[model samples]
Target: MNPKATRWAKSVAMVATILAVSSCDVLPRSGPTKREIYAGSVQREGDAFVIAVNDRVTRATAVIPALGFSDSFRNAGAVAADVIRPGDTLSLTIWENVDEGLLASEGVNFTSLDSVQVDGAGFIFVPYAGRIRAAGNSPEAIRRIITEKLQDQTPDPQVEVRREAGDGATVTLIGAIAGTGVYPIERPTLRLSGMLAAAGGVAVAPESAQITVIRGNQRSTIWFQDLFDDPRYDIALRNGDRILIEEDTRSFTVLGATGAQSVIDFESQTLSGIEAIAQAGGLQANAADPTGVFVFRNEAEEVAAQVLGRNDLIGAQRMVYVLDLTQPNGMFMARDFLIRDGDLLYVTEAPFTQWDKTIAALTGSLGSVNALSTLAGQ
Candidate 1:
């Protein structure tokens, strides 16, 4: 064996070894394939989660009530428009008629008393009346209380109270909302939806949008859509209620030969195989190998692999599932297969094609080099 020949033989062997490792399809003999596991075809027999075509009814129907304003409005209390705040100024006025004959005949006459501003403590110091707590009470109510207090000293006292400065009420909106700020409370009562509308509604990311209401130290979640659908759930906004709209963070990734390869935002919920594919833009023409489709998942050391083929899953009883796409009817089942987060879907290509191309390229290169050497020698 010449040194040159030996070197060429070694090079061919190395290339062959590379080809061997990269070439053939490796199928699991005892367990389900990755595609079967992903498709959920392999599962324990009689498992409650695994339902067969026969078990699924064709025309299952039920009446679902439409979401409406009445539903949201139900049980919701009326919210006051004006929310009282500090630093607001109020005016109190007292009026009485006095005879004028006193000045003309050494006597005085008066028709009304001067209006006075209420102090910071909501107290009004009158000529004869003493200090009084008037905060939080309505203007009319305050007038009646003050008039009664002054009745003992002044006869027929007519009293009036009016807001002098500052707004009557307000509500605060925050978090994932289009517009968040302090909104003036106008009416005597307002609903949750009204406040949300004033704050520019909830800013929901396509899938999960929720509004949270915080009263005192208690918290409650409200569905944004539900507010429009069911009036019963629409809550009343109080003076200091904090409304927060938020977007859920849980999401999943869809990749490979599907139409779209991106992260899908979901509310940490289960997804079916068909739904996942649709989210990824459906299957690609050349990229998807229906029979070779696989899903890889793990439970402790026991890894489950699903293989999808013609129309039926091979091991429909185990945790692993096999979806058969060869038949036209298989699509329906594929759509029913559920998918979970962190699950990887691989669409396999036809076997031996890559190997064939690699070998042909190497042989062609060798032939071209040999021909050049022969020409140079000649």
Candidate 2:
């Protein structure tokens, strides 16, 4: 055989040998795809941390709606006006018929009554009326009572009454508010919006604000966005109500394979799963496994049991919620899925990426062998 042919044959044989050896450790074409991570033996059910595998349609229809609580308060009007209480200040003016001929004192046709504050016993002492129960009575009702009492002495007296500054209901504002103090409810129609306005508005943007109302023994929280989205959330304020405006520093962490991974603050009070992912710069198209998207959250014991489909009550469950973005309705379900504070969203690497990496390494060795063959042939 010719020397050149002999060399070419040896080089071809060497190349075949390298390829055969490399095939031993080569990545399997497709042993198990990314979907196996969700259904495979690695992540089976009955573990301490239950994995809830929910499709887009099931999550969007059932789980998403159950995540949020209903708004409890309603619009009852600001400064509950009909009820008067102790500590209220009242001002009165008295006038008698000047034309009456009876014991009407010449110099005293009109009297400017002294301003009175309702005592702890719910009574206010007027000069002639003396120890009137003013706490539960409206200003108009008080005026009538005073006028009727003074009619005999002053002759068909007319009385006018007005509540002083401390007479009406008020809401106390605190934390991240322009003016953090007690503000009087000036109108009967005053609402959460109006009360916030009276307090000089919020120090931060509404999207990043949380409003909490402390009424009696119960406390309720509402996102600033929800307050803006629905008029029904702008409920009326009551006396001694404490309105706390807090900056929403709550956030979630993104990990695994994504465009950006960090603990990101929610720009608004409430955020959907899709919005949260977008905030984190979305998933990396090349590295991310769309079927292996997972959200890790430590849910309440009862809620976790219900979500995990467990009958017995267990401890606080750390839930791993899986969503398959490869489906058509994935994005729609994500839009409805609410992301809470401290949630960890992870996009596992695609299974084929391993194969690609392995192949690239094999190709580099083949290139080196080809270069050596070319040198030998020369």
The prediction achieving the highest TM-score against the true structure is 2
How many angstroms is residue 201 displaced in model 1 relative to the true structure, after the best TM-score fit?
Answer: 2.3
Tens digits of per-residue lDDT, candidate 2, 121-206, equal: 88888776667888888888898888777777766777888876574466789999999987766563368887787778889987
TM-score of each: 0.58, 0.65
RMSD of 1: 9.1
lDDT of each: 0.53, 0.70
Candidate 2: 10-residue stretch with minimal lDDT: 60-69
Off by over 4 Å in 1: 1-129, 150-171, 184-189, 204-207, 266-273, 291-378
**Which residue runs does candidate 2 get wrong by more than 4 Å?**
1-83, 96-114, 189-193, 224-236, 247-249, 268-270, 285-291, 299-313, 316-318, 327-338, 350-378
Worst 10 residues of 1 by lDDT: 54-63
